[model samples]
Target: MSDRWQEMTVFVRVADSGNLSRAARELNLSQPSVSRIIGALEARLGTTLLLRTTRSISLTEAGSLYLERARYLLAEMEEAEQAARGIDSLHGVVRLAMPVLYGTRAVIPALATFLPRHPELRVEIVMSDARQNLIADGVDIAIRLGVGLLDDSAFGARKLAFVERLVVAAPAYLLAFSAPDNPADLARHSCIVQHGLFGRESWRFTHDQTVTSVDVQAKLWINSAPGVLAAAVAGLGIALATRVMAGEELRTGQLIQLLQPYRLDPAEVYAVFPAGPRPSAKVRAVVDHLEVALNTPS
Candidate 1:
């Protein structure tokens, strides 16, 4: 990489990671080398980009403005390279964000198969339940599962599939405690509640065109879907989960789906990307693969 472009890359990584050492580790360079790159970039620009201390680093006003433009320039450069190589060349890194369980169980398996065909491509998966800032984080794509995409004009979304939340428990748990016939009967049984974007205390269900929100009490409150599934499998309680997430368990008869009469709202899975230039071949290839992998029947 050229000196100026290399400096911009280091500056962007530092800004994203918020720590010089961490960014240096990611860039596979020594701390002093990374620090010097940033120092040189600031000197060349005649402006301070970061306010740093022993504990943390924060962006200066100029840093914030420069970071935005730097990202655009870097993206354009990458696109130029890809265009010069030919549109069919898939030889770049694709940073993807997804929820923990779905990314592990669904996305990774698909990638395991898709990646071998293109040895030059690399996928970095960020597993988190919280929404990520794509541009700021340097993420190329995000596989999101929810009611819909957040109202952000900066992102363009393509619907992948519709996934429904199902109340399920292990067969052992169901055999020990009689399953609830109706939503209200859930009050007398143990319920595992997940506390995040979907409300924890209130579980919404629809029946006969009438929607009902049941206020559920729980001894166990979990934030991650995998943890909740684990707790349910250990016979702790009935947990609410997305069908896509619990597909294997449900198919193998490890977990029994319950309360079929009542249904929760189906959430749409989306491949969200930055609203800028057209996606490079690497990004488009992975997005297309994920769309087919996620939507196709198992």
Candidate 2:
């Protein structure tokens, strides 16, 4: 049983590390020994769990399923050990990943109340628009705002909110220049483009079950959502923004929604964590707090 547990632990580390040598070094085991243990386990199971290459290793279909179960088992084992040792308190740092603007507007404010209650728990926030490798980056929880999940098997996600993208501009700008009557009219206006994965110059809109793409001309190209909001509020140009990102501006009439007849694709907000057994207490606490805070009226 101890040997089985060791094999499970080693396999998990190898999966997480994505390199046998790195996993071996971290486990304080020889490379050959780690390789042999994995080989032995694969042979015993009569299936290949990982596909190895010269530079990297990846899980097979069977491997992915087995990995999920293995993580659950390991987590349960760890919980059992912690319980036996009487370490019931939730403490230690949880590394969280999220987009910068959303983290600033939604996540940080939520944690203001949450952090005070859990005096022993610390949190490290990784704010970026780029997709982060959860295992490589050691992220404990990730908050994603997007149309859908990129990889469902990799993490367990809980839906926090449904968000919408809005094409908006400062009321002053709209008064100075004619507002776009439709998606195509954006070509004649100065558009603030977000040059990222969502596309810089191309904006998509849907109406009456019809979808259209507009090749927008941008006088300003910004990578950050906050920057886009700031520029729009300053009456520089029109911008595409998420409702949550511009919630305050919209509420205070600093920005007005444009082309209301057409709608951009709605995005879902999710709190994701590594696929395993139930999440640790600290993870659950933060996720729970975010769920309520984000879902509440802004």
Candidate 3:
């Protein structure tokens, strides 16, 4: 690699690993050499990018901005090289961020065939339901499920699938408690809720130009999506769940769909990534595979 390329690569590694020794180990360089490279880069830029301390390392304002641009430029250069080499399947680690349940149930399973096709590629997955900082986290692609507005200038997003959500109950539960006739009737029944996403406080439903938000009585509040469905199957209470999450149960008659007359506000699933001129080959491949996999209903 060229001198500038080496500098940027080392800097990024240092920033990501958050330790000089670890970055040195990763780069196969001495710890003192890593420190010198960072120092020299700061001198060349005439500004400090990282503030290093004994306990932790943090990015300065300039460092954060620089890292974003550096990551983009590196990907672009790597893509150019691959194109010049006439390579079809690219080799590199593509770090992905996604929701836990979605990763387990959909994303991972969908990539089974596609992953084997690319023998040189490596995939690392970080799963969480919370919103992630794409650049700061070094995430190449993030699969998100929501209906909220997105910032156009900062990130790029592609619609993957329409998330079908609804209220559901166990056959046994409905035997004891009457099924909800409308959105408003949910307040009279017990509900199972998952934390860290929408519907924790209230569930929204729509019917022909009308929207209804119902405050549910949370008899059981859990953090896991699967746990929420399990609660409903156990006849604990009604659950607000995505059709994908409740597919098997709904099909097997373990859970009964409710509030059919009212339409639940569907969440839009997206493959979100940093805004750039173009996505790298690996990132695009994963996104394309997911787009096809998510759209094909199982």
Best by TM-score: 3
Comparing 1 with 2 on TM-score, the higher-scoring candidate is: 1
The sequence of per-residue lDDT tens digits that candidate 3 reaches over residues 110-153 is 98978888888999898887666666566778888765745545
Model 3 quality (TM-score): 0.86
Q: Could you tell which candidate, 2 or 3, scores higher by lDDT?
A: 2
lDDT of 2 at 89: 55
List candidate 3 stretches off by more than 4 Å.
Answer: 16-33, 44-46, 61-65, 130-137, 149-153, 274-278
- TM-score against truth, every candidate: 0.84, 0.71, 0.86
Query: How many residue pairs in model 2 have overlapping backbones?
Result: 0
Tens digits of lDDT, candidate 1, 152-258: 66666777778888999998898899998888878878889866645366778999999988877687888878888899888999888888788888999988899
Please give the lDDT score at residue 244 for candidate 1.
77
Ranking by TM-score: 3, 1, 2
Tens-place lDDT per residue, model 2, 1-298, is 4878888988988898788887787678999999999998899899999999998899999898888889788778767754764533556678899988888888898888788877777898999877778776657788887664546575777888877899999988998999999999999999897645344587889999999999998999887777888999999999988887898999999999999999988777888876442776668778988889988886
- Candidate 2 yields a Cα-based lDDT of 0.83
Which residue pairs clash in candidate 3?
none
